[model samples]
Target: MISWLMLAQAAALGIAGLVVAIAGLARRPFGDLALFAAIGAFATLVVQIVASIIAPIAGAGPTGDLLEYWTYLLSAILIPPAAVLWALVDKKGQWSTLIVGVGILACAVMVYRMHQIWFVQIA
Candidate 1:
């Protein structure tokens, strides 16, 4: 069965990314939006961490570490805030735009990977 928690995290990140992009376009203050993304990612991270801790018990180790499998969770947890921080620290428009693009790309890859995980059924 597909894991609902894992899917939930992906959905939340996708939504958060959309919200962040909209916030970017609207030219609004990003503090609250950043906080929302952080909280969503943090909550998702907690689920992933818990899953990692229980993986051996869940018998996924013959496959791989749950942590290793959850690259999306890791990216979701780190990338947005990192992009915002880069936005704050960088003086160059080129670098700031590049970082934002990278962050968006990471999230896009995450969405694709998530669809792979959820869309395929191992019958």
Candidate 2:
């Protein structure tokens, strides 16, 4: 499951990069990219949340390490919207790139954290 999350994170990063690249090269607002990343982040997090809810309900374990996963998941879930909202503060879209760019980087770190929590048994 964590591996799947990692893959999704990687895909999100790629889509993020596509948004960044397209925005940069085309001289277009990064808002489009931010929107793409935000939507993707929300969808991916929904899958994760549903899985987290069901995994334990199906008799997996007490919490199934919810404490371990929550920080990473929550950060990933919040990043896109936060970035998008922050992007809204600026009409020129400079902030959009900042938010989405950092969001992508954050996703990479979250992927690592997920592996650390699930496989390495780290808190």
Q: What TM-score against the true fold does each predicted structure earn?
A: 0.60, 0.72
User: Each candidate: how many clashes?
Assistant: 0, 0
Measure candidate 2: CA RMSD. 3.3
Q: Write the per-residue lDDT of candidate 1 for residues 19-119, one digit (tens) a residue.
A: 66666655554455555565555565666656655755766432333343466556655775677677667633434434444465466456446445434
Error of 1 at 99 (Å): 7.0
Best by TM-score: 2
Residue 98 of model 2 has an lDDT of: 60
lDDT of 2 by residue, 18-44 (tens): 566456556567656567766776677
Question: What C-alpha RMSD separates each model from the true structure?
Answer: 4.8, 3.3
Model 1, backbone clash pairs (residues 3+ apart or across chains), number: 0
Mind sharing the TM-score for model 1? 0.60
Where model 2 places Cα greater than 4 Å from the true spot, the runs are 14-27, 59-65
Clashing pairs in 2: none
